[model samples]
Structures are given as C-alpha cells and as structure tokens.
Target chain A: MKGIYFLVILALVTAVDIIVPYFFIGGIASLAACYLFWSALTFAVIVFAIIYTSQWGRRS
Target chain B: MKPLYVWIAMLGWTAIALWIAAAARKKMRPGASEFFIGGRRLRGFVSGMTYAATTYSAFMLVGLVGLTYRLGVGALGFEMTYLIFTVLLLITFGPRFWIVGNWYGHITPPELLAHRYKNQWVAVIAAAISFFMLIPYASAQLMGMGFLVDGITGGSIPFMIGVFIMAGLSGFSALYAGMRSVAWTDAFQAVTMMATSIIALLFTLYHFFGSPAMFAAEAARKTPELLKFTWTPELFIGLSLPWAFFALTNPQVSQRMYIPDSVVSLRRMVIYFSLFGFLYTIISTLFGLEAAIVIPGLENPDKAMPHLLGKVPVMLGVIIFVGIFAAATSTLGSIILTLSSLFARDIAKHFYPEIPENTERWLGRIVILLLLGACIVFAWFQPGLITVISSMASGGLLVMAPAIIAAFFWRRATAAGALVSMGLGGVITAVMYLANIYPLGWWPSVWGGAITLLLFAGVSLVTTPPDDADRFISSVERELVARGFRRH
Candidate 1:
C-alpha cells in the first residue's frame, strides 16, 4: 500500500468530518439529521477499509 | 436496584468468565510469547472481540453517555470521529505491525521501536511513558465500575466494594493465563457489553417513547439544545485529537495489532471492531439523549445513565449494571496485561538480557499485582471526571505518535528524535495537565502533538539516522508485497 494515498484520504475525511458537522449541521436542531450524517460518515470509512484491504494476501 | 440482584448477576458473570479463562489456559503453550500474546495464534473473531472490549470501557455506557447527556450531538461527533480515525489507522498500520511482530517475535509496541531505532533505550523510555500515562486511564475504568455499582444499588454496595471487586476480577484475568485468559474473557465481555446495551436501549425506546421514531422525535422536541451541535471548536478538537490517534498510540489496543494470526484475520479484526464500535457509540449516545429527555436536571452528568437505570425495570437495570461492569473489567484487564508485558519484555529484559523466559513471566505477574494495587488506590479517591481523566491518558500517550509513524514511513527519523520528542513532549504535556494550564484555550494534546512532530523532524534532520534504516524499511516493504499487503 502506498502511504501517501491513505494519508491524503484520511486527512480529507477528517477535515470533512470536522468542518461539515460544525458548519453545516450545527444549526440544524434535529437529532435525526446529525445522527444520520455521523453514522453515514463512519459507515463510509468502514466500507473504504474493507475495499482497501480486499487485495491483501491475493498475490500469486 | 437491590444489592442482592446485583450480587447474583455479578456472581453468575464471574462464574462464566472463570470457566472461559480455564479453557483458554488449557490450550495455552509454554513461553513468554504465549503468555504475553497468546502465541500470536488467535483467530479473527477472538482478536476482533478482544480489540473491541479493550478499546472500549465503561467510558462508553457511563462516561460517554454522560458526555452526550451534557454536551448533546457534539458528543456523538467526537466519538464517531475517533471510530473513523481508528479504522483508517488499523487498515494502514495493522499489517505492518503484524508482519514485523511475527518476524522479530516482538511482544510489546516499544520493542518494535527498539528494533527500528537500533537502541534499547528507545524501548525502555517508550515503555516508561506508557506505564506512567495509562495508570489514570486504567483507574478511570475502576472508578466507572465503582460508581456504577454504587449508583445502581443505591449505595448499599459501597464504592470501595465495587472498586475492589472489579480490580480483583481484572487482576485475576491478567495473572491467571496472561493474554490467553484476558483475550478469551474479553471476547465474552465484548459480547455481553453489546447484547446487554442493545437490549436495554431497545426496551428504553419502546417503553419510554413507544418506538425508535418516537424516541427521536421526543428527544428533538424536549431537548432541542442536545440535538443541535453546540460544542465550541476548542472543546471539540481538545477532546477528539487524542482519541483520534488512539489506535496508534494507546499501547493496550495498539499492541493488539500483533495478535491476529494472518492477513485475513487482521482484516476481520478491523471489520468486526469497526461494526462493534459504530453500534456501541450510537447506543451509548442514544441512551444519553433518552436520559436527557426523561431524567433531566441531575446535578452530576456522570449519574445520568445510573439515574436512567433507576427509572427502568429492575431486571433491565441489573442487566445494564453487569454490562458496565464487564466493560470496565475487560478494559482494566487488558491495560494491566499490556503494561506488565512492557515491564517484563522492555524494561526487565533490557536490564538482564540473559533472563530466562519463566523468570520474565514471573516478573510480569508481579508487576500486574503492583499495577492493580496502584489503580485501586487511584480509584478510591474517585476523580469524578471519568471522561476527562481518560482523555488525559490518551493525550499523554499521544507524545509517542510521531515516533511510531516515523518508524515505518520516514527513514530519516533517528533515535534522538524519538527519545527527545517523546521524553520532553510527555513531560510538558503532563505538567500542563496537572497544572490545568491550557495555553490560549487549546488542549495540551494539540500543543504536545505539534511540539513532538517539530522535535521529531527537526532533531532527525540534525542527527545521524540508523545505519540499517534503509534495510529495515525495504525488508518490511518487500515482505508487505510478498504477503500481498501492498501492490507492486
């Protein structure tokens, strides 16, 4: 795995995670909206991990 | 809420945990490796469950719930940020740790640093930092247990009794069979934590607000401030920064990257742990919101969950009580086991390189008892800031982050860089925490992390790099591709 790719992706995700919650969702006073956004963000990262590791140990 | 019910439930849980520990000990082989890391033969499920159990603590049901009750949706954001960072770090570093650990037979995280830096002092200092930082975090687990039992039983159980019971159970799991017993019991505890929390959550949703939708609607309507993201930027970053790097910094959980048997098992470990963490974070936060809506106006936010328990049916209250007990005990056991291995493998072996494996193991057992004694004393006073204390531990350990990352990715990184960075950075961060000095309203973690990074890079630029830095990095890189962890 190239370290830079993972680093950039993670940095971007973290930035978005911080900025979106504070800027976009902060004013929305609904639990469902904030809760859904966080759940989706976390779930997306997990899916990315799954896909990223799918190629491991597959070399012939 | 009766002490009798709590006692009976605890007894049944202890019986089951001991039975599992005994079974694990039977299968355990004879060696320091076996004692310290289950001989690195653990399968994916056990590895995943233990990771879940160890990474989480009563901090989830008790501490995090309280944080959410007080702070609102920002609490969920902070926790979810941690989960996101952990999964990313695991995917990036898990295989590297597994490959190096298996090749070098390294039992502790600091040992990995020693090999990379070609200096034993690197390992010793790293281990020392871990020992000093994790004590408060471990004691916070005990205090969580003590407070929960005391709160649920209406103080009939007494705080010290709860503390002693958890410390005793955790101490036994660590001393009995080391990692084998701890991992097995942790797997059991992880299941119990998830299952009980889920059941209680569902019951609360249905009983309190008629359904999940109703619960959400009522939460927004009744406590609109909680639903709104209200945390200040300083507060959010201060709390989330240390926890964000937890998978890479905390020795107790970071050391777990060495346990899975293969690449596939490592993958499974990350996936399982991710799912468990996501679900548990949501459940804990939902309970916090429910408590805010149903049982508002509590003087101490930490008592939110326990107060909510009082409002629930007796059976459900007891079930949630055991869940928090299991969470605290599992986390405490894992920390004790990891610290003992660090003491034995890094410190003891560094002093006496010719020490026999059995002697090292015995020394580890002795350290486990001493660490438990210290934690019990710490818990007895009850800091009452469970979440803050836990975060302080993580922040202190965050000093090691630059050293660890540079070990694999930056060949120019040197021994002086790691030592100066961790040593000085740890001291400054610790002093800041003790003195309650937050420079310019920022947490110590942010300042410590920034200072450590600067020290690591700047010092390495002036100092001599290890002669074998290239060989070490290339060999690991070659193996990564051979093991299919990386593409050519």
Candidate 2:
C-alpha cells in the first residue's frame, strides 16, 4: 500500500512538471500549481506513514 | 546621506541575536548530540525557521539577485527548481533520516555515511569535502555582508571592518550556544527578513506603479526585455539542475533532518519549509527586478539592490539594511555551527578517541574563532563578486551530491564507487571550469554535478554493492519500526 501511494505521488508530480511548462503557464499560476502539488504529495506520504505504523503496532 | 538610525538598528538586531544565543547556552549539554542536533528537542516551528534561514542566505539575496538582474526572469527557474527537489527529499528520505540519526546517535553526515557503508574512509572523505567546500562558501557570506554594510552606510564602514564585525559576532554566537543558539536566533532573523521583504516589495511597487495596471504598463513600456525570459539551453539545464541536486545533497540541509523533535514534527516542518522557500524566492526575485528597473545601466550588476536602497527614504533604507544583515548573519551562524561540528566529530574524534566531551565542545569553539579569522583574511585579500565565489563553492560540493544520494537509496552503491565518482567528478569539473569547456560558459557546479551523477551510476552498475548492504537496510528498517513507521 505504501509503495503504491509513493508511485502515485511520483506520477502526479512528474505529470505536473511536464504539463505546466508545455502549456506556458509562467506567472502566479505556475508557482501556485507547483507548490500545491508538492505540499499535497508530502502530506499524502506523511499520512501513509502514520497509518501504516499504527496498524503495525496493533498487530504486534 | 542619512542619519545613523540605520546603523543603530542593525547593531540592535545583532545584539538581539547574540542575546538569544547566550540564552540558549544555558540549555546546552556537553554531549555531541546536544551540540550538533540540539539534543532532538527543537519543535516544528523552530526547525522550520532554522531550515528556512539556513537555506535562504546572503547567497539568495545578493548572489541570486545579481544573477536575475543579469539574466532576467529566467533565473527564477533556478530558484523554483529547489522547491521540487526539497519536497522530494522531505517525502522520500526525511523520515528515515530522522529515525536513523536518533536511533544510532549520529551527529554529522559522515557519521551516517559511515553507518551505511561500514567504512571509516568513506566518512572521512565526505567530511573533508564538506568542510573544505563549505569554508569558501562561508567566506562568500562574509564578503556579501561587507558589501551590504559598505553600501548601506555610504562608505562609513569599510568592507574589511564590516566583514570582521559580522564574522566575529556570528562566530561568538555559535561558539557559545551551538545548534540551540543558532536555531532560536534563526527564528528571530526569519521574522525580520519576512518583514523587510514585505516592506521592500510594497515600496518598490509604489515607486514604480501604484496599481497592477500601472505596473504592467510601466513594465511593458520601460523594460519589456525583463519579461522576455530567453535563456541559453545550456544554462537552463546546467544551472537549475545542479541547484536542485545541491538542495538535496548539501550536508547543511541534510543535517536538519537529524534535529527535528519527531516524525510528526518533521512532517509539519516539510510543509512549512516548502511554503517558506516558495514565497521567499518569489519576493526576493521581484525585489531584484525592481532594483534593476530603478537603477538602470549600473556598471556593477551586483550593486543593483544596494544602489536602489540608497535612493529610498531613510526609514526604508534602514529596514532593508536590517534585512540584509539578518540574511547574512543567519547564514554565518549556521556555517560556523556546522563547521565546528565537523571538526569536533569528524576530525578530532578520529585523532583522539579518548577526548572528554566538555573539552571537545570547547575545542569546537576555538575552531569557530580560527575559521572567523581565516574568513576575514580571505575576505580582505580575495574580495570578488558573490556570484563567482558562490558558483565555485557550489561546484566543489556538486561532486559529492550524487554519491551521497546513492549511498542512502541504492543498496548497490559501493564505497569504491562513491570515492571514485566524487574524486574524479571534482577533478574533471575543476579542469573543465578552468579550461572554459561548457557552452553556457563553464560553471564548476554544472559540469561537476553532471559528471558525478553519471560516474556514480555507471560505477554502481559495474561493481557489486557494499558487503553490508543488507545489514544497513535492515538497520534503517528497524529504526523506522522503532519510530512508529512501518517498513514497506
């Protein structure tokens, strides 16, 4: 599950990098999109780590 | 040209930073962990502020601004690249690092490298490169501070005197308080920096254009070239790629992962720091653009910001001076602290295994003083453009970045591969830089980083991974388990 989440985040970031520049979004929108994508990815990973750890503790 | 109010405010701010350092010393422990990583007690806000302060230095304000002035909006690409790289670092490796460093009691990057490779030589080599490359970068910080003081005071303070004062104060602060001192002072400095940026941006907009429509019209009429954003392909790839790579592999930044209080705090900091990096980069670049527009046809592009400050109102000039001082001193404080840690943990521990911790701490203090003196000598003798020194310093470190990343992630990365790639890449980069080989004009960092990555990847594929690869992986996995994070 964690590995899958990581791959999804990676794909989304890669897609944003490719699409944003190709469309020539050069001003505030480009900056906003980049920040939003990065923050969201980071948040998702943190959530996965936390949930995964709690489940492992319960099993043990 | 103005009253002494600006100088007074600058001095007062320095005093406040010094006081904070002094207060933090009371909490300082004699252990290496306390000295280097603040004993892992730093909260999310303090860690975020320190990370931001250390990352945004005189280099960003002075060197980067000068680049933008010369290259126009295209330089924003370099600044934005780091946002992507830093977030990647935070998500992929940040939690693992915090867990390992805490579980294993690691203090420096080399210590972690030693753990992963089980080779003392690898740790020694990485430490040597970090200390040697970072000193020149620290010297550039001193030079930048000197220039800012000279410009703001209208030559009332000589460059050498300014360098001495700033270096001496920062060295003393780091000597007394260690990372604890540096982190708290960074919080204060970060606030001052943000305030100054807001005021400067507003003032610049008001002077140039009262509204968005007016500003656009003025930008179109007066300096349409600034909006064009045409850069050479070589520069587009070489400069931005190396910068992004550096933010991930730079020892100073990696060391931050060791100090956060918990995985929860680290998670919070990653978000705060990324936002801080984005906002500061845009604000600083806009400030640079305004400076370019106001101070047209300046012979020295680096003087654009200082020259613009000169033409502003007295109060505004004072505020900007405070901002520059905060930027310079915060960076200087971090450098001094990091260098001292490198000397004590990597150098002194290797030579004298039985040295007392208290004695070692004082030794670190003495090394800070020596470094300050050395930087003063360099600042006096080799006073040059901040951009040149920055690029050279960065070029040297770029060679190490690839090896560092591979050491942590790629289980097949050998100690031999790490050594060969870093040494060969550094030598080639230096040779190419000297010979003027690259199309965007031979920058040490660009060539060095590219060669390092290629060589490291090639060497890793041809050679077997380190003998202890499985053990190291399990240890990291175990650390994550202990920290409440499950393995994959």
Candidate 3:
C-alpha cells in the first residue's frame, strides 16, 4: 500500500511535468506539482515514523 | 546609507554566534564524538534546520539565482529533483542510518562501509575521495562569501579578506563546538534566510507586479522562455538525473542522517527538510525571475540577487546581505565539520589505531584549520569557471551515490563491485565532460550516475552476495523495531 501510494504520487508529478506546460496554467502547475511532491514525501516520512515508533514501543 | 551600520550589524551577528558556540562548549565534553556528532543528542527541529540550511547553501541563493536567470524556469527541474532525491534519501536510508550509527558507533559513512565490507582499505579510499571532493565544494562557498561581501560593500573590502573572514568564522565554529555549534547556528541562519527570502519576495513582487498573474505576464513579456517548462532530452536525462542522485549520495548530506536524535526525529526531519527545500527554491527562483525583468541582460547572472536588493529600500538591502552571509556560513560550517570528522575518524583512526580520543579531537580541529587555509589559497587562484567547478564536484559525488544505495539495499553488493562501479562511473563522466562528445553540454552528473547505477546493478547480479547480508538487513530491521517502527 505504501509503495502504491509512492508510485501514484510519482506518476502524478511526472504527468504534471508533461501536461501542464501544454496548457495555459502559467507556471502554477509547476508550483502545484512541487507542493504535491513535498506532500507525498512528508506522508512517506510520517508513515515510516509511525511504523518505527510503534515497533520500538512493542520491543521495549 | 551608513556603511558603518552594515558592518556593525554583521559583526553583531558574528558575536552572538560566537557566544552560542562558547556556551555549547562549556556544556559539552572535548572529545571527537562529542565535538563532531554533538554527542548524538540533537532534537528534530535543530537537526532539520541544520539539514535544510546546509543543503540549500549559498549556492542555491547566489548560484541558483544565476542559473534560473540564465536557464529560465527549466532550472526549477533541478530544484524539484532535489526535493525528490531528499525524500527518497530519508524514507529509504534515514532510519537505517540512525539505528546503525547508534548501534555500531559509526561516525562517518566510510566507517560504516568499512565495518559492513570488513575492509579497512575500502574505508580509507572512500574517506580520501570524500575529503578531497569536499575541498572544491568548501572553496566554492568561500568564493561565494567573497562575492557577496564585495557586492554589498561596493569593493571597500577586498574579496579575499571577505572570504577569509567568513571561512575563519566557520572554521572557528566547527573547531570550538563541532556539530553542536553548527546545528544551533544553522537553526538561527535558517530562520533568518527564510525571513529575508519572504521579505525580499514580498517587496520585489509589490514593486514589480501586484498580483501573481501580473508577475507571470511580466516575466513572460521580458523573457518568454522564463515561462516555459521545457528542457532538451540531453538536459533532462543527462543533467537532472545526476543532480537527483547527488542529493542522496553526497557524503555531506548522507552524514546528516547520522546525527539525528532518534528514528522519530529522523522521520520528522524528512518532512521539515523537504518543505524547507521546496519553499527556498521557489522563492529564490522567483527572485531571479523578477531580477530578470528589472535588470535585463546583466553579463553575470549571479548579480541578479545583489542587483535586485540594491534597488530595494536601503534597510532591506542590509537584511538581504546578512541573509546571504547566513546561507554561506551555515553551509561552510557543516562542510568543515564533516571534512574534519572524515579525516579524523575514517582516515586517522584506520591508519593509527592507538590514538587517544582527545588527540583525535585535536587532530580534527587542526584538519579544519588546514582545510580553511587550503581553501583560502585556492580562492586566491580564482578559477574563471566557477560553475564548472561546482558541476565537476557534483559529478564526482554522483558517481558514488549508486554504490551507497546498493550498499544499503542490495545483499549481493560486494566491496570490489562498489569500488569498480564508482571509479568507472567517475572516469567515464569526466572523459565525456572534457571531450564534449554529446550535445548534453556541461552535465556530467547524469552520465556518471547512469553509468554508475548500471555498473553497480550489473556487478551485484553477477557476484555472490555478501555473507553478512541477511544479518545486516536483520540488524536494520531490529533497529526499526527498537525505534518503534514495525515491519510490514
């Protein structure tokens, strides 16, 4: 599930890189894409943190 | 405008930074581990700020502005790639590093590599390459400081002296308090940089265009290419990929993972660092674009920031100068500390096993001073091709990224394979860059990284997996467990 989310986000970003310039979004598309990239990355970090922290707690 | 006030403000900031260093020193022990890694007690916010400040550096502010000014919006691709690369770094490697560093008492990348590969020679060679590559990088920051001071002061102070002052302060910070001082200073610098960037953007946008739409239209009118998001295939594949890889594998950056307090802090750092990197890039690029509209066709694109700030209110110019210095010094301090640690822990410890901890700490300090002196001498030579130096260093480090990734993930990876791939990757990229065989034009990073990754994957597939592969992987798993992260 995590890997799937990563792939979907990456695909969306790549699509933005490809399609946004064709239309007249006027650079906002690039900005939005950058934000989405950051969001996805942040989500991944949170997921890892939750997993790691929970595991640590269990072991103790 | 009173020049004296500007000098006073700069000096005042320097004194505050020094006081913080003094305070940190009093509380900390004087040993290599304590000095270099801050006794491994840094919290999420401090580590995150340090990572962002060091990663962004003066290059992003001055050099990146110039790049955007010349290359237009396509340069944002470099920034985007960096964001992606850093995210990949944290998710895949950060937790592992935090656990391994604490568990094995690893101080440097090569130290960990040495233990994993069971070869001290590998660690020595890796350290040598990393330390030498860092020289040009550190010198570039010094050169940037020199340029910033000269630009702001209008040549009252010699560029060399400016370089010396910034570099000397950075050296002192690293020597006095090590990573602890560097991390605290970075937090302060990061805040100042973000504030200055926001103020500069607000002022530039108001003075030029009242709205986002107006700003885009104006930029389009001045340079239509500025609005375009296209890059040639050569650039997309050749330049972008290498930079992305470098964002992960560069020893300076990878080492940051070693210093975070815990796995949870490491996780928080990833989010904060990505946001910080994204915001900094967008604002800096916008500043460059606005500068393009204000001052058309300046021979040096690097002058965009200074030129734009010069037109702003006098008070803002002083603030911007301070911010630029912050960007440069924060980066320089981290680089100096990393280089010193690499020398002391990786090189000296491997060769001379009997050195006392205090002696090693002194060796690290002396190494910092020597590096500073060497950079000063290098700065005096003043290479005409500053961008080339940056690109070459980036390329060299990109060659090592694949090996690093494989070392972590691929159980089949061997010491010989790692070394061969990196060496060949670096060599091929250098030859191609010098010969200019392709139309790629000034992008060794892509070529080097592609070749390196291919070689690494190929060699790992053909060779027998390391005997300790399962054990190492399990250890990492246990570390995650210890950190409260459960396996899927």
Candidate 4:
C-alpha cells in the first residue's frame, strides 16, 4: 500500500468511527454494540498497518 | 486497604525496577548519543515496549477509567481514535525520522527541526515550548500515583509520599543510564502494567457479574445512558484533536522513532505498540464501565479506579496498585529523560558549542533532577483535571505539527515560518488555556491548530525558502525509495 492509499483508507475509517458512534450507536443503549463496533474498528486498522508495513524495509 | 501492604508492594516493585536499571547500565556506552538515544541501536521488542509504556501512562488506568465511568462509550471512541491515528502516524513518520536522525546525527526531535530549518533558534524555541507544556503532562502521571495511593490506602499514606516516591524512582532510572535504563525498566513496567490490569479487570468482571457476557449485560442495564454515545461533537473533537496528533506532536514518544535498530525493528515497534494500545484501551475502558455499574455516585470520577480497587481482594488490590505505579513511573521517566535531552542538546549545546559529550550528558543529568523537582511540586498540588491537563499540553504542542509535517513533505517551508508558527501559536494556545477562554464554545487546540497552519503556510509562501530545502526533500525521498519504504 502506498502512503496516499493508507491515508485515504484512514480518512474513510475515521469518518465511520465518528459517524457510527454518534448516529447509529447512540440510539442503541447496549454495551455489546458499542464494544463490538470499536473493537472491530481497532482490529481492522491494525490489520491495515500489518499489510502496509510488510514491505517497509525490504528492497524491491 | 492497609498502608503496610501498599508500602511493601511499592518497595518490592521499586527494587525490581532498580535491578533492571542496573543491568541496563552495564550495557550502556559512554557518549551523548548513548545516553540520549541508546546509540540508536535499540532492539525491536524493547523499542516497542518502551514506546507503549511511555505513550500510555497512568492516565490509562486512572484518568481514562474515570472519563469512561462518567462520560460513557465516547471514552472508548476517543481513546481508540488516538490509537488509530498513532498507528497511522508511526507507519508514516517512523522511517522518515529514523533515516533523517541517522543521517544527521540528530539526538532530539527539536534538533531535527533545527537541521531541516537550518536555524538553531528554531530548535531552542521548540525545546522551550516543550518544557513549558510537558511539565503538566508529566505531573498528571505523578498525580495519578498520588491518587492511587491515597484512594486505595484510604489516606493512611499521605499523598505527598506517593508523589515523592514516584518522582524519586523515575528520576533515578533516568539519571542512572539515561535511555538505556529508562527503556529497559520501561519494558518491565509495560509488562507489569498489562498483566496486572488484565488480571484485575477479569477478576472484577467475574467477581461482580460472573462472566464477560453478564458484565456487559449488567452494565447495559444498570447504566444504559453510558452505553449510549453522549458526548457533544465540540467536546469530543476538542479533546481528541490534540491526542489524534499526539504521535507527531509529543516529543517523548516521537523521539522513540529515532531509536529503532533497523527498518524491520521499526516495523515491529509500530505493530507491537498498536496491539498493546488496542488491548490496553479496551481493558481500561471496560474497567471504567465496571466502576460505573458496581460503584456509582462517586463525586470524583478520577477516584473510580482507586475505589474499585478498594472493593477487590487485598492481594489483587495491591497488584493493581503496583501496576498503576509502574505505569506512571515509566511515563514520567521517559518524559524527564526526553526533556533533559532537549535541554542539553537543543538549548545548552547550541549556545555553548564547545561543551564536550560527557559534559553534555552531565548537563542532561542535572536537567533531569531539575525537571523531576518541578513535576513533584506540580503534583504536590494534586491537580483536579488530570485528563484535561494532559490534553492541554498536547494542544500546546500541536503548534509544531505544521512545521513537523512540512519538514519532510514541503520544500517551500521556511525557517522563519516554523519559528513564527510554533512560537506565536504556542503562546496563544497556552494563554487561552491559562485564561480559560474558549472562543465560540470550541477548544483552544482547534483555533490554535488552524492559526498555526495558516501562519506556517502564509509565512513560508512569502519568505525565502531555505537553499537546502529542495535537496533535503529530494534526497530523503530517494533514500525512502532505496530502502523500499516507498514503492515508486
């Protein structure tokens, strides 16, 4: 993944992070939904990091 | 609940930390670089652990728990957002900082700014702003210790003693072997922090609600409003904006980007720190929800963790106490060590120019002593808003974000622009924080960030760019491609 691609992905995820919490999760008064959403979001970002950094130090 | 148990636990933990520091000292080499940045040869795991420990402080178990208890699911969102931004920033800036630091022999983040801007005053001013801003942040760490001891022991042990003990141990670790001792002890502390917090969290869940699923059900039913996202957009954005940029703006953690041994190790540092942050954030926030459900109506939200500890078994309570202590001490040690390096290298050595490497190291040691003294005094007062104070410090440091980003990406960024933006923006933000003035119900960080970006870009556009700016950017980009950090 290139830098621009990573930035684009992050921007989209961040928007989801903010919007989902306020708009969707706000109406659900259950801890399960909120916890699941954040955990899944954080896990996804970490996956992206792993993919992006796989070739960081390798010579092409 | 007993003062004796608290003292015994603390003493044992400090002894182990000192032994680790002693071992690290045996491996230490003599020089300014060795003292400040571990000769830039730190292994990946150590690099990652120290980064995690330094970045996530006592604030996690203490301040974050309280925020979660009072506010609700927004706390998790705020913290997770910080983690995501931090991981993204590290992946982006880590290689750049590592390569530039190695090529230029830069010992501190401000020194990198100085070299890129080609102006010593820029580094000096940045270091000064760091000193002015970070003291409160460090004090928040100490304040966490004080509150932990005071709350858990039921005020049997005075707050000042807790404050003094943490300050002394952290100072000793930093002064003994500089980055070597600090980083090694930090690895130990990081492990202790995670283990103890996880054990305590699980026990709390089981002891109170019988299972994780039950705990979630109980929390949702008992405090449904907290499960709902309730923070205002202004509050959420204001609090998170500075922290979102923390990896770039906070000099303590940013300086770690210079210490990895290789590109592979740098990669491990980012990945490990991310995983660690992810787990720790979830645990800390969960503990907050538990506190709200189990013990509600506490006047001071910051007391939630300590109060929860009081309800747990004695052994578990002491274990968690040591964990919070370890967390605070490691963070304080790292901050003190980084700030001292900034003072010695950017401020002291810049003006003197003739100070020997050994003398520079000694100067840093002296500054560590002075810095710890300042933090202890600040913590003595026992600040009320630990989370807010920590955020304000980052907000103040946010003024440098533009200059920092521009250094690697924009050739037109001028030294004068960096100076004007950082200096003016820092002062204005600090004043707003001091004067308690938030214009239009927004945060100083928000306004300060916008103004700083404008100042940096506007000034750089009109001023003469540095002659070496183009060469610096092109060479760094070429090196990035050579190292396979860039695909094309």
Indicate the fraction of true inter-chain contacts that candidate 4 also forms: 0.69
Writing each residue's lDDT as its tens digit, candidate 4 over B389-433 gives 999999999999999989988889999999999999999999999
| lDDT score for residue B195 of model 1 | 98
The chain A TM-scores for the candidates, taken one by one, are: 0.85, 0.46, 0.43, 0.76
* Chain B TM, cand. 4: 0.99
Which one wins by DockQ: 1 or 3? 1
lDDT of 4 by residue, A1-60 (tens): 345665787799889988888788776888767767988898898998899899897786
Fnat of each prediction? Answer: 0.80, 0.03, 0.16, 0.69
Per-residue lDDT over A1-60 for candidate 2, one digit per residue giving the tens place of the 0 to 100 score: 233454576567645544554345333232233333434443444454444333332212
In model 1, the runs with Cα more than 4 Å from the true position are: none
* CAPRI quality level assigned to candidate 4 from its DockQ score: medium
Candidate 3 docking category? acceptable
lDDT of 3 by residue, B1-488 (tens): 24565677679878988888887777686567788888888888888888888887777778778877877766666566556655755765777777788888888887777777666766776776666667887788888778767766677766887798899789888988888998888888898889988887887788778876688767766677665655665665455565566545567777888887776577667667876877788888887778778887989777677677668788888787778888888888998888888888888988898989898888989999998988888877866445556666677677777667666666778777677776677678667765765543636666667778888788777877668977887677666655554455
TM-score ranking of the models: 1, 4, 3, 2
Q: Find the 10 residues in a row with the least total lDDT in model 3 chain B.
A: B434-443
Q: What is the C-alpha lDDT of each candidate?
A: 0.92, 0.71, 0.73, 0.92
Estimate, for each residue in B385-433, the C-alpha lDDT of model 1 and write its tens digit.
8999999999999999999988989999999999999999999999999
- Of the two candidates 1 and 3, the one with more favorable lDDT, higher being better, is 1
Give the candidate order by descending lDDT. 1, 4, 3, 2
Give the Cα-based TM-score of candidate 3 against the true structure.
0.89
Which residue window of length 10 is worst by lDDT in model 1 chain B?
B145-154
With a 3 Å backbone cut-off (N, CA, C), the pairs that clash in candidate 2 are: none
TM-scores of all predicted structures: 0.99, 0.88, 0.89, 0.99
